[model samples]
Target: MHESFRLRVVETKMSKMSKEMIHLLGNYGHIGFTFVAAIFIGMGGGIYLDQKVFDGRTAPWFTFIGLAFGIAAGFKSLFDIIKHQNKEFEDKD
Candidate 1:
């Protein structure tokens, strides 16, 4: 009976830890996806403007601007996620 009780307790703890780990992984995946998505969207917009609107006259200039914007947007998203996570942790405490 004593051994069985201890085994059950250990199993419960392992299950809980596994769930938490999965949740953490999901959060990280979301953050990475959002960051990359923002960058790609920004770059795509810039490309559209340069090629379609300017007829390629703007060429690399618009592309560079767009790339810069994309990078900035990515960083902004990363920071925002970090802040949100920090807030959640604080609330839990």
Candidate 2:
């Protein structure tokens, strides 16, 4: 009877852990997409400027600037998401 009770306790803990893992993954998926989209948009804008305004002479310069902007935007977005999540958890508590 004691061994059976211990086994049940372990099973319960495992199920709870699995649920938490799934929830974490779902949050990560949203953040991942946001980061990718921000980067692409920034880079695309830079490429367009370089091609139309710079006449392709400064092709790579604009592209590099766009990439930097994209990286910064992505990190800012990630931080915002994390801050929001933290606030949510705090409210729940």
Candidate 3:
């Protein structure tokens, strides 16, 4: 008598996620994580600039320019993300 055990190499298909889905999820996750990270970084930078350039030093009224630029960049990134999401949805449809 020969006895054999069924080996599951790929597990159950129902429990596995597609590579595309995983990749998309990873992209969105990184975007969200980076957005959060950039917020913290921007806040730190803004505070540093406020203290070092605007509060303590007698400089031009351009100290907050960098902060404004950083905020604009963040908003631009958000706009790009929304555009990309819309394009993806259109493509899927």
Candidate 4:
């Protein structure tokens, strides 16, 4: 009976660890995707505006602005996620 209980406890711990690992990995994946998507979307919009609306008159200016906005957005999202995660950990503790 004692042996069985020990085995069960070990199994439970392993499962919990695996679940935590998966959750952490998912968060990382989400962070990466959010960052890249924001950058691409911003740059793409800028390119479209410069080309379609301004007819290339704006040239690289709009592109640069869009890129800067994208980078800022990405960093913001990253910080927000980190903050949220920290809050969650604190709450758990």
How far residue 31's Cα lies from its native spot in candidate 4, in Å, is: 2.3
Ranking of candidates on TM-score, top first? 4, 1, 2, 3
Which candidate model has the greater lDDT, 2 or 4? Answer: 4
TM-score versus the correct structure, for each prediction: 0.76, 0.68, 0.49, 0.79
What is candidate 2's TM-score against the reference? Answer: 0.68
| Model 1 C-alpha lDDT per residue in residues 1-93, reported as the tens digit of each score | 999999999999998889778867766778878888988988998999999999999898888888899989999988987888788789989
After superposition, candidate 1 runs with Cα above 4 Å error? 1-15
Model 1: lDDT of residue 44: 93
lDDT of each: 0.87, 0.89, 0.62, 0.92
Q: Model 4 compared with the native: what TM-score? A: 0.79
lDDT tens readout by residue for model 4, 1-93: 999999999999998889788878876769989999999999999999899999999999999999999999999999999998899789989
lDDT of 2 at 30: 90
Residue 52 displacement (Å), model 1: 0.3
User: Over the stretch 1-93, how does candidate 3's per-residue lDDT look in tens digits?
Assistant: 122222343434523657568757755756766666656666667666667756846343334554565666677777777788779779989
Q: Evaluated with TM-score, which candidate comes out highest?
A: 4
At residue 11, candidate 3 shows an lDDT of: 39
Cα-lDDT of candidate 3 = 0.62
Instruction: For candidate 4, give the lDDT of residue 83.
Output: 91
Count clashes in each candidate, considering only residues at least 3 apart in sequence or on different chains: 0, 0, 0, 0
- Which ten residues in a row are the worst by lDDT in model 3? 1-10
Report the number of the highest-lDDT candidate: 4
Model 2 pairs whose backbones collide: none
Residue 79 in candidate 3, Cα distance off native in Å: 1.1
